[model samples]
Target: MTTSSSSPTVDHAPRDPADGRWTPRLVLILIALAWPTQLLAAGGILGANAIAGVAQAFHTTQVVWFGLTLTLVSTLLTPFVIKLGDLYGKRRVMLAMTALGALGELLAALAGSFWLVLAGRAIAGFYGPFGALSFAAVRDVFPARLVKQASGVMGSSVGLVAIVSPFLAGWLIDTWGYRGVLWFLAAATAVAFALIALLVPETPRHAFGSRLDWPGGLVLGGGLTAVVYALGQGQS
Candidate 1:
């Protein structure tokens, strides 16, 4: 008896439409978040040169120490800021960081001494919140499927900005000077901050606590400073 057997057919899942159409608002929001982050990080491209220029302005090498101090402090502060974002809202934390950075830039522009410049650098240390918290915000708002692509675009923006920031900083230094560049950066940062405040929605995800822990901030800041300083001095 020869009998022909029929095989069961497998079913496939539905796919997303490939219409190439996207919401303008979402795209614009992503661009806003990404572009400013790129600009802020790029703000550091000629950062070493800026410190040297500050050194010359003060007629001492201590300004370089100030820059290094800020870098160390900022590195230490990063985890705390991220944690804080996880506590409060990511948008609020990010806005605060951007505002602090802008304020620091403004202070640096007007600084008259190495100590004053160092203070400004220290003030600017919270800038890490932008990229990280912005990411948190994206995760809050966007679909899981799109978040990866969005993150990729944002990361690429940083690289693209890096390619241009140093040249721009160099030109600004030639044309206006370090202080001038600081002023420009400060103004631009403030504008960006304002844009974020106006446009971005606040996102509170996995943020449960109300009380901000000071001990965490201090321990994180001090420990990070020790480790990063060790590595930095090793490089030197």
Candidate 2:
């Protein structure tokens, strides 16, 4: 994950923030290198795999509906991820997103119910912050000067992959089946979580991070779950 220090030009040696220098070009490149992998872990592959089970559980007719439902719920949860970052720390938020995404993918792989699947999908969606946070992580890791360039590079890498993620995810599902795809995604997410643990460091910004807002998280998560479930169910 990232901290407020969103650039790649980080001082390996402890230096004052004022002394820390980052290059926009270098930070952008790191983000670019990391983008496709993040997309595969967070969106492109896992998302497409999720559709098969949702289709099987809810019917093909409701696949679109399920997607819509999940999207809305994700919208609800996404801000909380950011806000929690504001309150706590960005790295903590990102770790939650990664870990939760991994858990959700595994659960969905074994899901038995429409409700259960919805929950799993929601958990998976919680990890969606890779969309925004990689930049934040770059910001966290690098100096302020280079953060933008790094963002561009990382953004470019993933942007190119965006065109193909769906097709690739689709092929995996078609070739192997839903469970297989989920299992693979689960493994991928787990790896991602491990990488975050190993490669990424917690931000000093959140060293004295804000308290977790359990009530807010629950209330928001619950409301979103209800809305997504209803939409997936396609009520009149």
Candidate 3:
């Protein structure tokens, strides 16, 4: 008997099939993540719709800077934002980004100077990573089998917002001007923050003990900024 001893086997199968199935909680998480993603995607159209008003308010013809600043800042910030989420926590970074985005929107809404408005747009660019982070968060939280479906849901939000945001932005700009558009963004971001706080759970998987490659990030950001700037200048 002593010579025939063996280690006991362990069962690796899922305890319950329902554990990974679609549920109300997962649905809520999807909604919470999708809300901010749609808002982030809507920024470009909103800015375009309100450009004339913004240029007149600022008394400048260089209305391109409004969109340009946002695009550049977002391009620069997205990599860092994604890394931070991986190192620390997705939910934590998302809440901070949403809050900052709302603050940026408010600043733009209340700003009286052209420079201040640009600054606000730069800050709001933090929202750029919302879609990427939301997708990652969905992957982290949803069961493997359901990831594709969840991703589809998240991807659809952008298209849906695109269809509606132009009409909404036109209405807001017509009724209340560019500042009103900023105010609407601030309000929407606030709602997103609340929903995320209430419904979205923190992801368990994190690249803990891993460090962000700051030097690489800086190099990449600089290169991207240069390329984007050149493209914009070429277009102009």
Per lDDT, the best of the predicted structures is 3
Runs in model 3 with CA error above 4 Å? 1-17
TM-score for each candidate, following the candidate numbering: 0.83, 0.67, 0.89
Top-TM-score structure, candidate number: 3
Tens-place lDDT per residue, model 2, 1-236, is 86675432222312225434554444333634373245544464456555766677566555654345446656667656665655555556666777887898788778776667667766776776566565666766666766676667665666666666667677767777766666776677777676666555554443233566668877876687677667666765
lDDT string, candidate 1, 1-236, tens digits:
99753422112112225323345556766866886678667776767557666767788945556557667767877777877776766777878888988998889888887788778878877774467677766776565677788788887777777777888888878877778678877887887788787777666546463556778877877887898788767745
Total colliding residue pairs, candidate 3:
0
- Cα error, residue 216 of model 1, in Å, equals 4.4
Estimate candidate 3's RMSD in Å. Answer: 5.7
For model 2, where is the 10-residue window of minimal lDDT?
A: 7-16
After the best TM-score superposition of candidate 1, give how far the Cα of residue 164 lies from its true spot, in angstroms.
Answer: 0.7
**Candidate 3 C-alpha lDDT tens digits along 124-166:** 8787678778888877777788889989988876888899989
Sort every candidate by TM-score, greatest first: 3, 1, 2
lDDT of 3 at 122: 86
Each prediction's total of clashing residue pairs, residues at least 3 apart in sequence or on different chains, is 0, 17, 0
Checking candidate 1 for backbone clashes, the offending pairs are none
